[model samples]
Target: MSILLIILTIILPPLAVFLQHGLGKDFLINVLLTALGWLPGVIHAFYVNKR
Candidate 1:
């Protein structure tokens, strides 16, 4: 990952996922994860981005 993506992931997980992937399953799931908790969203964003 680049500097911007890492920053976005820490700051806003969903946005990171959106940038890495798009408006699809990963993005939708990241949205939910964010709704649930910031940490979870960040974790999921990292996981999704890894994939």
Candidate 2:
């Protein structure tokens, strides 16, 4: 599950964040980061990974 989430994070950060933490702070942050920079969003999404 963690591996899958990580992969998803790499591919699509917002979706990965939404899957991990739902439509909360992390999700909002992921979207913001994605808008600011793609790599940052990927990193943030991976950081939010529960497992």
By summed lDDT, the worst window of 10 consecutive residues in model 2 runs over 42-51
What overall lDDT, based on C-alpha atoms, would model 1 receive against the true structure?
A: 0.92
**Of the candidates shown, which would achieve the greatest lDDT relative to the real structure?**
1
lDDT of 2 by residue, 1-51 (tens): 568877888999999888767899889988999999999998888778854
Worst lDDT 10-window in candidate 1: 14-23
Candidate 1's displacement at residue 1, Å, is 0.5
- What would you estimate as the lDDT of candidate 2? 0.85
List TM-score per model, in order.
Answer: 0.93, 0.84
Model 1, position 43: C-alpha lDDT score:
94
Residue 17 C-alpha lDDT in model 1: 94
Pairs with backbone N, CA or C atoms under 3 Å apart (clashes), candidate 1: none
